[model samples]
Target: MFSGAQISLYPMADDFVSVIMAALTGLDPWREALRIETDDISTLLVGPPEVLFAAMRDLFVRAAQTGVHCVLSAAVSRGCPGEPDDPICMAQGGFARDLALPDRIAAARANVGLAAVTGQDVAAQFSLYPLGEGPHMDEIYGCIDFLKASGTFDRSKNFCTRLRGDAGPVFATLCEAFTNFGTVAGHVVLDVTVSANSPSAR
Candidate 1:
């Protein structure tokens, strides 16, 4: 046996384990070789490594197609064949409370002023909204709201923000989110620089 298993899932109020579970329910029809279970803090899925990895990959792809943003934290547990662990049932509300945090996304909005300075051609110092408003304000607000509650963010102010990510994943996510809200790709203008030494330095 591989002796190792991995899990990739997002953190929701209820953790939406079902959405992930639905993607993986078909992974093992036998459902006897291994055990799958969840608690309030984490979802414990155990099985063949190959099967689990493939299943998680598929889950992420499906989540993207569905336009549901998620922060994926992985869990790698080594199981001993001598004994079967009791179904995971210990944690917050029966699940892991180690919720995902706010992710910084790279974004830009039409800056008519910057366009004028650059003659709408070569790029220049631009002023733009990092988290521009989308057509579906309510939906975005709902997502932000949920993030505030489940993601352990302060709900006093607008959750939408301006910041950067360690990698381009955050930017990619924002672009996808905007596109889903009917943003015209041509209008977005961003000039974020990524460097290994200092991501927030000049």
Candidate 2:
């Protein structure tokens, strides 16, 4: 299986460059575990789900901690048919593919419950796509059920769901939503945008 994310970070400040560069240090701990490549447009992180989401959380939190409004946009995907299998992408202790939908939902919730608290408040909205054949809506609705009970769920929007809470649980929730639904070897994608310190919130 191959898993990765294309992410872009925006800092609402004049010194955006400095903020982004400094915040990149947050990925240091995860570097050995992930393949990180940066370009002018976005950064690509290829790795296991556990390390992937944590890296994103750390990077975003570091930027937000600069007291600047920061937004993180990510296109996360796993098991893309077009991508070759990568040994480094192997994950440990994830829900089995044959698990019932309800069972997966429960496991996802339990995973989110153990997330580390980062104490950084953030708002996020995301859409999960379980591509390919199978009971897609059932999977989505199951994800919704998990989200409603996630303690971070804010509301349901037109094409996405919103969540608000400390960065830890919020990111954890996103991670579970990404990993739990859909066939384990099927293509799955998640579109996410997370914001902190936005002037609109103040």
In the range 132-180, model 2's lDDT, one tens digit per residue, is 9878999899999999988899999999999999999999999999889
Structure candidate 2, residue pairs in collision: none
lDDT of 1 by residue, 148-196 (tens): 3321222233323333321223323222222222222212222221112
TM-score: model 2 vs. ground truth: 0.98
The runs of at least 3 residues in candidate 1 whose Cα sits more than 4 Å from the true structure, single-residue gaps closed, are 1-8, 11-33, 79-202
Q: Give lDDT per model, in order.
A: 0.32, 0.93
Q: Per-prediction RMSD in angstroms?
A: 20.1, 0.9
TM-score for each of the candidates: 0.31, 0.98
Cα deviation in Å at residue 188, candidate 1? 43
Question: Candidate 1, residue 105: CA error in Å?
Answer: 34
How much is the lDDT of residue 64 in candidate 2? 95
Lowest summed lDDT over 10 consecutive residues: which window, candidate 1?
Answer: 118-127
Error of 2 at 62 (Å): 0.3
Model 2 collision count: 0
